[model samples]
Target: MAKALMIQGTSSGAGKSLLVTALCRIAKNLGFKVAPFKAQNMSLQSFITKNGGEIGLAQALQAMSAGLEPEIHMNPILLKADGNKGSQVIIHGKVYKTLKPKEYYAEKKKLWNKVLESLEYLKKHYELLIVEGAGSPAEINLRDSDIVNMAVAEYLKAPVILVGDIDKGGVFASLYGTIKLVGKSEKLIKGFIINKFRGDVEILKPGIREIEKLCQKPCLGVLPYFEELSLSSEDSLGLSYHKTFSSEKNKLIKIVVLRLKYISNFSDFDPLKYEPDVELLYSLRKEELLSADVVIIPGSKRTVEDLLWLKSLKIDKILKYLAEKGVEIIGLCGGFQMLGKILKDPEKVESDLKEIKGLGLLDIETTFYPKKITTQAEGYCNLKENLKIWGYEIHMGESEGDLNLFTIKRFATKEIKKEGSQKESIWGTYLHGIFENDDFRRFILNKVREKKGLTPLEKSYSYKKLREITFNTLAKLVETHLNMEKIWSLIKL
Candidate 1:
């Protein structure tokens, strides 16, 4: 059996995911077989493994860092939150069922056994496993039913490292409170890590010592803020912190992305952020759309619901005007369905929305069914240049239209399809991560640049290379600040 070390946060968004990823990279660098495990993950940002099983985006990144293929056992239980009061429950990389919060809590014991089984399976394959806990284990009211945090640590006898966000202004209090709330399980916590610190380490020494005294655990490390290191975020919180571009003087092209209430896979636009000539703005404000050279509707978790929201906000009309004015309009996945003439969810898979009128940007109709299409795809963009493009499709509904934008083939499979539509300046597609391809992304951007008589960029950023660099940088950064020797000793690595 493999040794396990768990990282639990004082609260949600306390940098648990990134820390685990860094650890995985370090372990890999040390020539140890490492894997990441999160018993239960709730996020809209997901990735499909080579085996066609779905896992959290962060876990996939961790797997890449560890030099291993992502597997279902890494994330046994995935809860994709719907816009409403329910979530789609995915178990062992497949959709098991949907459950409300109350119902899910009642069934935690059943899920707990499955989690243990998955952990055992992972232990058999890896030398070490770096587990991550969801949210805080200190939620006193929910501790009894907690399978993801302290319970997992206790069951596996994994030494725990409690992480707290110093940037949030209550690091010591939060760490101490979390330790106290865990009661008897506090013994499992070996140390504390203070993350996102900005000031000098000397200035924080007093407080760090106080926290250590309160929790009866040594302060493992104080990590400096590494904001420039860009990795795929685990959830919507990553989008919230990103500042929108308001200064158009420095940018040649301004792109506006509609910030949907239920947006998923927003990382698809990260490439645009690195473009020196492009100003990417993700905003809910309609006025921002007026200044855009290109307008984009990002993927949504609840397509029909978010579409209704657009209707309520009257943003749909503005999109139509932009498309007519020759401003490039692009929609992805759920957003593609929203741009169509109509959307029908007869099975109520997404919501109770059986039929609803769309924004009518494309002469297409989508019908939702229980079956979900989730797979990687590659093809050429159906344009004059026939540019190459590759991405994955993860959606519950399918659309039919005549103007095909991309001829797609599922990766590692013989399946092929003519996907999406392109009518004049308006375009729609079901693919996520389409912009990651440098050639395809530049091809689209250059068209807009040509319209404005701006020079096409001579260079294009490689998203794949950027991801590799970010992971390496993150691994080095954390290893420098963190007590890796102690961590290795604890995990017997």
Candidate 2:
């Protein structure tokens, strides 16, 4: 069996995911075949693996850091919140069922077995497994039903390192409380790490000493706050921190993305933030949509529900106005479904409503299906044939439209099909990560610049290269701050 070391957090957003990612890189750098594993992940941000299995985006990124391909075993269970309808549960990268809180808890035993199977599979293949826990292990109320935190650690006999966010204040208290609350599981916790520290570490030494005394666990390290970290967030809670761009005067092209309540795959637009002449904003305000040179409707897990939310906010009317005014409007996945004239969910896959009216910006009509399509796709733009694009598709149902925007082929399959629809300045596609393609993205942006009589930028940076640099930079940061000698000893490396 492979050696296991787990990272657990005091609270959500306590930086557990990134810490695992950093450690994965650090372990890989030391010549160990490393992999990341999470028993359960509740996140909207996900990626389709090479074998067409959907997994949490954090594990996928962590796999990349470890110089390995992301696989379904890395994240055996994924729960996507479907608003009031409940969460859509995915087991081993396939849709299992949608269940409410009570219904899901009833299946805890079965899910726990699946978690063990996945953990065993990883252990056989990897030399070291860097595990991450979901939420806090100290939720005494849910401790009996827990499959993700202390339970997993105790099962694997993995040494646990608790992480607390110093930026959130009361780090010492949170760390102490977490260790005390886990009861018998406290024996598995070997150390504690304080993350997101902004000030001097010396000032925290006294409190750290007290926490160590109280919990009987050594303080591993204090990681400084890194503002330039560009990793994709594991869940929707990080959305607020991602809204760094504003309608600055220096930026020539202003792009506004409708901040849908059920937004998924927000990372689709991360590349746009790197553009020199472009400013990106996520807002639901009417004025922001009206002032944008480009408007985007992003993917959502609950398509019909989010569409209704748009109508309630009167953002539907503003989208139509923007389309008529020749604004470069684009929709992706569920957003593409919402831009159509009508949506039919006859099987009640998404909601109880049989059918609902869409924004009516496009001439297409969409119907939800019981089965979801999850695959990596490659294609070329119909309008600009030289502009090739590749991305993953994760959505339910299909759309019927007369205008086809791109020709695409699913990876590992030879069949060619027409995808997306475009009419004048309005575009809609089921493709996520379309903006990450340099040639196609630049073509769209330059067209906007031409309309404004501004000079188009000729140079574009490679997002893939930037991701590699980011992984290395993060690994170096963690290695420098943390007591790696102790970490290596704990993991038996």
For TM-score, the strongest prediction is: 2
Off by more than 4 A, model 1: 238-251, 384-386
TM-score of 2: 0.96
Evaluated at residue 445, the lDDT of candidate 1 is 88
Best-matching candidate per lDDT: 2
Per-residue lDDT tens digits for candidate 2, residues 1-493, read: 7999999999999999888888998889889999999999999999998778889999999999999999999999999988776899999988999999999999999999999999999999989999999999999999999999999898889999999998999998899899999998889999999999998889989998988888889999999999545687766555553243435565568889888888999989888887777877888877778889999999998888889988988888888888888999999999999989999999988889999999888889998899988888997999985779998899999899755898999873656899999988988998888987988888899999988887787857788887888889988998899998998889677
* lDDT per residue as tens, model 1, 1-493: 8889999999888999999988998888889889999999999989887666788888888898888888889999999987556899988888877899999999988899889999989989989999999999999999889989998998889999999999999888899899988989989999999999997799999887877777679988988987644576767765644344335664468888888899998888888887767777788777779878988999998888899898899898888888879999999999888889989888887777689999888989999999777788888887956678888888897898765888988874667889889888989898888988888888888999889987787656787788778888989999899888887788676
Report lDDT per candidate.
0.86, 0.89
Report the number of backbone clashes for model 1: 0
Clashing pairs in 2: none
Clashing pairs in 1: none
- Cα RMSD to the true fold for all candidates: 2.0, 1.8
Task: Give the C-alpha lDDT of model 1.
Answer: 0.86
